[model samples]
Target: MAKLISLFFGNAFILAYALDESTNQVEAINLKDISLPITLDSLQTKETIYPIPAMICFDDRIFYGQEVRTHKKFFSPHTFLYMKQYIAKNQHLPRIIGDQEISNFQAAEILMISIIHRIEEIYGAENISMYVFPVPPKGFEIFAQWIEKFCFRIGLVSFKIVDGGVCSLLAYGLGHELGTNFMYINFGPMCLDLYILKVEESSNEPRLRSVLLGGLNKNYGSIDIHKSLRDELIDYNITVRKAAEIVHHLINNQTFEEEINGQQLHFSRTQLHELLNRKGYGQELKNILADLIDLASGIGVTYESVQYVLCAGSSLQVPYYRNILKDFFGYKLLYNKAHNCPAARWSGIPSASGQWQYHQGQLRAPQPDSKGRRL
Candidate 1:
């Protein structure tokens, strides 16, 4: 029998886990423990190399997540493929990486290949039975078909694409009994997604369905705040990492003081809040949440009707956003207390893990029918 693996393609990170049938343990693969950065002049480079690091090198040009602190040029650490504006669109816009003009499809394909190479190293190409991935509700079929084609090309035994919202609910259900209706908030660097989910029972098996979805506002996320802070402190030569640290501190209501190039820089919660307010971030968040609430109400899912509000993504850790959610949902908000569980941190993990459990007969959800309906 072959082993099962789950690969979660998150906005900021790519996480993978392997399931051991004998021990019934899910082992997480350290995605950061990737091999040296591969310098490829073209995306078509077919050398069977190890997984590339977070930083990719196009020809002689290199981008770094850690080096952003000292590097003069501002470089985004995230991949273009996961960006919200590109995820749902079929446009093949060209991005300038060094001197190379790489299309969106080429960059995404290269990234996908790197992810597959990493998985292949740990479990071996032939040892894997199936690979499961989860995609967002919007553009579900298109994204699922795109990922399925990639998996098929690798000659995997099988491949499955599950609904991202359902996966999140299942992951939460693994630790707690879920209510009949719940809301899932995925506030990440790329975008903020609000999902209203319903849990139904058929033939003693639980079936998960997305009742309604709203709030795919790409402009509103922690990344925007980070960029704002970086621009605000551009005169002081602040690095991206330092700006992010300051944002984290301010969000947690901690004062941050640092000296750079003989200049002292200080940031307070009040000051940061004022800055964000000036930039209309606070209002933008409120508007997005309000729109989502209105959309839910249209489908007859009122605030009081929601049983639980499950939160995911790193952006929700910010007090500004968390407070907004708390004020809106009150006591219905649920925070993942599994500090040690990777699923708690990444939005895609629970979905992938939930699918893994279903494959192992651990989760009691009925399989989807030909029309992708659970009956």
Candidate 2:
């Protein structure tokens, strides 16, 4: 059988892995610290070139310092947009931005080719057959067929689009008892992903599996704070980069000082907190959490029966969300701070050991790293 590949296309970033069909294990090539140059021509080209560690996008874009600086020098000041909300518009939908009309299909196709270029550098050109990926939630599949067709158009044959069950389970190393119910929230810069799952025993194997009861992704992420802070400093001509740096400093429990346009602004943690309060970040958190609680309630996962809440991904590394998870979920919360899982670790919710949702003709969710691998 051709090897399977695993990919996680979260709002903030893209991660891909090669699956060992024999051992069912995959290792990630270290790519986080490395940065590749961005080009207008590469977006439309697909022929051979030197391999590099980089990625494309689906809808939203996130740029590290490297690309931002490069874009400012070579392209327009608005060459790229980062930490933006996920727009669920259909393919071919007319959208106007910066006097340019670009359809959703064109953007996604560009992202696909760019992603394929990255994958080529990782696993060679033709080593993959099957794929395992995660989608946001209920409405994700509305245009999922386009993704499958895109894969084929790019020469990939088979694919699977599952929910966020496996990533959450392995991320926190939670218990997978049949009755154990857990809530997973992946807080991005511009979006939040919530999943409530119940562990169920697999009919094909002796391992446990998590089944999604309800899932939701909404526009409540760290960018919301950046937006709020921008409003508070509307008088200052602060760029998004400058404002984001200030927010980062505050999140790290340090005073923030930045020169916006010509005026210098400074604030301490206490002041940052007051600003957050003034802009109702706490209230927004309450609203988002309340909605998640309602999702849990809809799925019959009461506070009493719910085993724990797990915050997956890198957002909790920030101070505000770290506090939010603790304040809201309290002692029952676990957070995934490690980008790489340990070598000896295995999934608390095992999927590869069993026949995946294979019987129902459903795509199998991506499993965890059986060995330590970094994105």
Candidate 3:
């Protein structure tokens, strides 16, 4: 029988899977070394007529592994990255990145086309009967309209669009528990999405969560970590690449430094913590906690119903935010780890912060209600 494919449209990358013949069973996944890019070739003619606006590369090719901070000479003309957060967005696209003018629809189409291309390459076009894609929070209606166009353009006959946070729940494998609710907080380059999931009582299947909040921090994320550090280190004239290396060293080791042009730039874990605290990120962490409490309470999230807090993002893996999450969720804090789910891949986050999705704890899926089932 032909296989069913599920496309994971991440904030910075695109990953997909082929389902088993059995009902809703995921047989295979890839977690590492499959981070794909989104690009559009300005050189390409409109008459070329792609299934979508963007492809893995519209009119050119891209090779990863060596880090390229700025697209400049390294990337092709018209190629773009970090556009996933803008798909289905109501606002105009952000000012050109890498001298590329990208529409939200184009970005999403490029990403979708890229994933579909990979799927077709792997399983053959005729083998794919349907697709399962998760939509960003606050983008259900827009995504629906966009996806309708997407399916028509791509000739996808059937598919399902669920909350992206719910994909976190599925990817992390929430256990089945009665009266327990799962809270997932994901930080992407463009925004942070929060999803609160509750299982149905009758079928024990996870359903649409009551707590669905997104775009919590539109202009903040792991990128801010790099930008803030790079800007601060600029006082001593450290290069962006060196600053990125220093940031990486801080995440893995206790202290680190580099000599650039015979100038010593170094910082220990103490300085790292202090820097974050001095910067607005520490306050951003606090703001996140406070908002969680307020939103949880406002949405009727009680200790009785709320069971666990799952942090699923490369940005959240940082000890800085993990410590705060620990304080808020305590033992209930479950994180996503790269080791646990080998079949997974970074959900389109940039390499700067996205690669740090080391390991996070896990939780049990909530028990569904006893009436009509929603999975």
Give the candidate number with the greatest TM-score.
1
lDDT of 3 by residue, 188-250 (tens): 433455666653332222243222532243334565676677787776776655665677677
**Candidate 2's residue-wise lDDT over 322-372, tens digit each?**
776688888888774323322113322233323342212345544433442
TM-score, prediction 1: 0.62
How much is 174 displaced in model 2, in angstroms?
2.2
Residue 45 of model 3, lDDT score? 32
**Cα RMSD (Å) per model?**
8.8, 9.4, 10.8
Q: Please give each candidate's TM-score.
A: 0.62, 0.60, 0.58
Q: Model 3: residues >4 Å from true position, as ranges? A: 1-107, 114-132, 137-145, 148-152, 155-162, 201-218, 239-241, 338-375
Scanning candidate 2 in windows of ten residues, the lowest lDDT window is: 46-55
Candidate lDDT (C-alpha), each: 0.55, 0.54, 0.50
Better of 1 and 2 by lDDT: 1
In model 3, state the lDDT of residue 322.
Answer: 71
